[model samples]
Target: MTDDTLEDFYDAIQDLGHPVLTAEELARALDCSQEEADRRLSELAGVGLVGRRDVERDPVVWYPKEWDQQARRERVVTFPNRREFVVSHPEQFTRARLSTFAHLIDTNGSGDALYRIREEDVWGAPYDDLADLLLALRRVTGERHESLEEWITRQWKRARQFVLRTHEDGYTVLEADSESLMGNVARQVLGEDQLHAPISDTESWVREGSEGEIKRLLYDEGYPVRDARDLDTGDPLEIELSLELREYQREWVERFTKQKAGVLVGPPGSGKTVAGMGAMAAVGGETLVLVPSRELAAQWRESLLESTSLSAAEIGEYHGGKKEIRPVTIATYQTAGMERHRRLFDERRWGLIIYDEAHHIPSPVFRRSADLQSKHRLGLSATPVRESDDEVEIFTLIGPPIGTDWSALFEAGYVMEPDVEIRYVPWRNEAAESEYASAVGHERRQVAASNPAKLDEIRRLLEAHAGEKTLIFVDWIDQGEAYAEDLEIPFLSGQTRYAKRERLLSEFRHGTREVLLVSRVGDEGIDLPAATVAIVASGLGGSRRQGSQRAGRTMRPVGGAQVYMLATRGTEEEEFVRDQLRHLQRKGVNVIEADAETA
Candidate 1:
């Protein structure tokens, strides 16, 4: 049939519930002559996509049935499985017949075969008819036929796929993962309360170990485990554990131990690492902490040792530079990205896993998180807002959010909040505005960098906050270099040597250096708590996450402090600042617009 006529026929079937359009009806719908409509219907019928069924009483009238049983038979025989049937008749029949029988079993709601069935019923057969079909199939195959035994064995495997017997009169869907599939099933079947009834020991054990291990542990503890795979592999090793958990941190441990996965979002220095350590202590098993950068990984190693009784030998570091996986290993995300290294982590299922700087989780790392059945999972970050959709993946694989409010940390005197100020500078001359405007795209950022108008303003802000520890945040290396050269302050960037970075950070930490200029490297996981003032010379286009990290640098409670963000008026920078402010506002950060005159 012609494409136009076929489209019309399909649309008519959808709208009118059948393709039985008379020539007269088609003529009116298509605005064509009756002869033309009759021609199209003839072509459609010839193609076997539609058929004419004669009415018993009306000799001239007929209805359309899209393809009768003969046409359907031809199509079904041409299917891939049908071709295989013609090539290997008996073997094909065995497999196809078994699959069909399995479907029949499922339709009847037989617990053994229910996993194969998707619909409520097949044809018009009632539940009892399914039982009769099973008996008939068994008789046709014969009691001694190997195919019959194979089919029954396959049914057993399929049955195990759906139902998981946890305890006496307690069951859960076997396919459930980090997000509870059985929990959802229970809500549909038994209502919300029964599904959410404080998770049992078996459920909690399953959250921590593999299904086999959970079954084995339960059987060993005399819980009448039926699954053979649950056989014990012997007692798991006991690892050293020590932690001082706050009330909130201890409560978080209880919830994590029960649920097995969750996130911890709190501002910088709110004890995310410490709380995660406490959860690991509760697990009392080997732990691995993953961080975004090597620096943060090292910082975590130190923090864990300082807060707990873990010895230097107990903790190992894994990153681009180091390669060691101790009982309690601390690894950089970069190392986790390595294929071979990731395999090692997968092979060794740590009891508890912690993600530091959790917002920076990449897609690959998030996928790897799924293969791990860690009994306890803890994601730590001051800003859990991710820059990509991978954030949603992390939320699914890592579990749910569990922690106290960031502002509550401030209220409880756990972390400090800084005073913030925003400064705007307009180009003083026509030549400067033209230069700034002409620098669009990549050059636009450079134009804003070397505006010369903001140099003195940056110096002025530094002068006002002089003698106090200060960090000048810049976007471009050229801008940072120029500022460092003109201001005679130490500078650090990706180009800086490791030794120089160590020295610069040390000098800043001590009282020797009053001012330091840095690029994005210093945005997060750096301990610059001594610095009380931050001058943001360039901003990362509307990224509230970046803004939070930049502002958080000076938020440490070394007495009250201030944050200054410099933006060029009548440029993309203004719109960028507005976008960033929107993100900060959601996090309870209010940005006030001011000028140099106010300072």
Candidate 2:
């Protein structure tokens, strides 16, 4: 295969949406002979533009030992088209586009002008020229916008009439109509034609072309673009193009890059994963990201590959299902524990270690993380503390918590702020309540918490939120199984097989299965952005950390969400609810309760 054919093969795979293609398929697509296709595929693979996997011996295949299966040697091939493009054109795009307008204003005008422009205006710029200039200015000096024209208009209108009276006996009144001056500026400068004309044509073209390009880019990159917005300054903003790093995320990354290790705490959907990815990018080294579950590990791997120039081969997964190790590895915490425990310090030098869902780090994992002598460590989680105060070990071993308040994220609209409604469902009979009370011990409490009575409430909640993706959190496996059986929906627990769990999670993510009953395993790391409702059927004792983590399972900032915490009135469950709120207090989460009717 010539170099041109190899390049054509890569481009063809990309244009075809990066589908996995065999040599014959590639040959047919490229209108070449099978032998030519094979040669080009080999050459492409040599340059790392494509990946090849032997399919004949795939353990996933049925009748793997069959004679026919042995006779038919096949290879599954995939092209890293997106990664190649990004690697070849890193200067063309960035995860975080610099604020060109703010930069220019700061460089050319007073710092006050930069401050005067609202974040909306700064982010909403429609002209590329303006955006580029602003970004350039910001690159030279740090500045940000705080207010927009609408804010200025409102302030001007409010200050339109000013009364003044002379101190003398005869009062001289003076009144100035600020509205007229503001109106003139509004008409002459801020008018629709004036403010928008500069970018009207260019913005329209960008809107039309960039959308298709972004969609194609994201699809070729193997991820979905959730939403994209165009700034008024003509800069197109694509969330899929880059993860938005929160202020705390930026600070944590900066600090962690300097220190050996540190913990990051924020509520769920507060951008922990975004921060971790950004930190990895900032470090510019071979980073390893460890999540808590296989599903989460895959999700993170996909997200990183899609959002950055990183290749599938560059990102590795070491979980129950996947056994691959690359420079940028993403593995389940459990799997990571096995690898770290098996290897000596001298075996590998991990430039950076990123722990997602850091709060779930078990005692052994905490010890292992502490023992690692990586150059940098970043612990990420919406909830960083365990129910037990033993979290001090994590802090001491991992590092300090460099985090911001969770409410701020809600205020910033970075995450959904739940309107929690507590419904006190009374026990059907005193006998049931007595039985529940009898099971007050630690182990029994979990079983009692998921009693049959709570199942009825869960059914009602599911019925009420039908058609919407809801995550039901139960305390015990039996309860999850019962719920799954009764509702005929997928259930996930510790006993779930790795491949089945991945399938179930994929269905849930794609809106195929709208409701899922899960054990405590769903409390961390997994990304269920489509889930907008959560039913806390049962919970462990008053561990607010658990409650918050469970709540965060559905707190992804997307569509509106409603969270319900069903508790049996006048029972231990009620006390557990109260205790959980107290735990959230430490993380600066304010639990506002409303009536059941409101729920």
Candidate 3:
């Protein structure tokens, strides 16, 4: 137990020239019982100072630390503690990083600075051919090699990779490194047998959402587990609200305060900003608000200054033209993902991250923003559903959604009453019809989506709704500009200057402009609470989501809402309305065949 005793034992062992000792023999030599000698051996081995053999009985020989090298070279080694090490020292490790997408592991001894293995190189091919390929690769790279499987297995372990699986639905098994609590839960809950071996040994498992839930439970039960990945606990959000929260908004803030993660989905104009700010106040630390666009970022800055006690001085903007990082920063998802902004995010200590229109963060470029460290992450969106990679990322990066719908908010008098209509206009233009029939795929869909026949319906809808502040969504910018020009109304598109778009939106909101033409840019996160009627003149190609988002423009609590979706029948345009508008129909939207109204 004493350092002197261990030193004497080491000297005696080497002096004996055959230091291996049975418990009884060692006990007699040390003038003690066999138990005492065994205890000494156990204590020495505990710190990796010795190795023991002959387990069946007490007659065991203890070897010094010199044998470890031999053991490693001759054994199937596994690093069970790799997960802990990687998490604590993420900087030191690289998961098979290359120019392309990174795999979780690199073949350590694969000689080349970049060690890569493709599926085509290793899988479903002849074993001889695979071996030859690996041998050749190793020879060229000058890496000492072994059996192909062994080399790959070594890389796999180093990668610390695992897949999270679900049984009921077809969800892609996310290939992630088990360097955080997220990864650990997937591995531990999926299969105990697989966990016992090197993680590479159990490359796949059948799991469910409940497995992820268990990790949350473990955290609640006081298990020492990390809840987030690569996040800094930013400044405590100093929440100063200018207005009081409604009952439901208060409930949302409460839930987020407790969990410190997850999404809040409420109908548009349901005061999600207030709820998010309330969460910030609850956390009371430095914060970063990420939005889908520069406009949304400005909107967040304005709302923060207007509603909360936080001043413009405290709030910073990270966007296309402006790059200021203060205690509370507002940034576009695009800007936040850029290399410089990413460094700023990583360098700063952030307590809270609130995503306005959180669904956007799940996109390919935007998802990288999730890698920014934060103590709390909150995503706000009316509909958080996505048909892309972000769908899964939303669940993992933030948490599940805590939401209320249009009807729920409507019942509470928090949102405007909605009037939904589908205006199916006949495709009467033979020339356009011929062009569409002759075209295929995206070209055909584009032709159908921007059909000239929809122009007549647009005119009729403007006539019918003539005076109400109106927002018209067009499928293409050229069409939007033409419609704006024809009607003498301003058009807003991606090319519209920020100041001009803001002025146009202001004029529309204040009744100076009766009608405004807009491209797809207005489909998300832009607030036009005053507009009661929206004419969806044309929509993105077959995207129900785009249609749904455009409809969201006016569904907020302002009363007397009428939404018109213009669709050209007997073409791919009709399919866009049908496929994209199905969910709206299911939600009690009064979809009518409105050729009569047009006539």
| Worst window of 10 by summed lDDT in candidate 1 | 106-115
Which candidate number would show the highest TM-score if scored against the true structure?
Answer: 3
Q: How many backbone clashes does candidate 3 have?
A: 21
Q: Which prediction has more favorable TM-score, 1 or 3?
A: 3
- State which candidate, 2 or 3, has the greater lDDT: 3
Tens digit of lDDT per residue, candidate 2, span 1-599? 45676566656667666445566766777888978877777766666555566676431111112334333332211112210111111111111222212211111111111112333223223233344534543343334323333342343333223222222343222222354522343223223322222222112112221222322232232222222221111111112236566665786677566544567766777777777777777767677677766777778878887777777767778777877767776766665556553363225566677877677654665344444435566787665556565664454444545654554455567777675666677665567767776774675566457556676777777778889888888877877787888888788887898779888889998878888888887876567777889888887464667888777776776667787888766666677787775545433344555433222
Model 1 agreement with the true structure over 1-599: per-residue lDDT tens digits: 47788778666656666646666666777889988987888787777656665666532232444444433331111112111111111222333343333221111111111112211112111213345544544543443334434444443333232223344434332332223433443223333322334353223223322343333232232221223122222224344346556666676677677656677766765666677877776777788888777777777787777777778898899887789888888887767757777788877767777877777654565444444445566777777666663453444445455665444455456567666666777776689889877766878866765567788788787778769888888888888888888988878988898778878888888878888899988888677768888888886473678888888886653466688888877777777777665545444444688865422
Sort the candidates on lDDT, descending order: 3, 1, 2
Count backbone overlaps in model 2.
Answer: 19
All models: lDDT?
0.60, 0.56, 0.63
Residue-level lDDT tens digits of model 3 in 172-226: 2333453453346544543552232232433333232233333333323323122
User: Which regions of candidate 3 deviate over 4 angstroms?
Assistant: 1-232, 540-542, 586-588, 596-599
Order of quality (TM-score): 3, 1, 2
RMSD of 2: 25.4
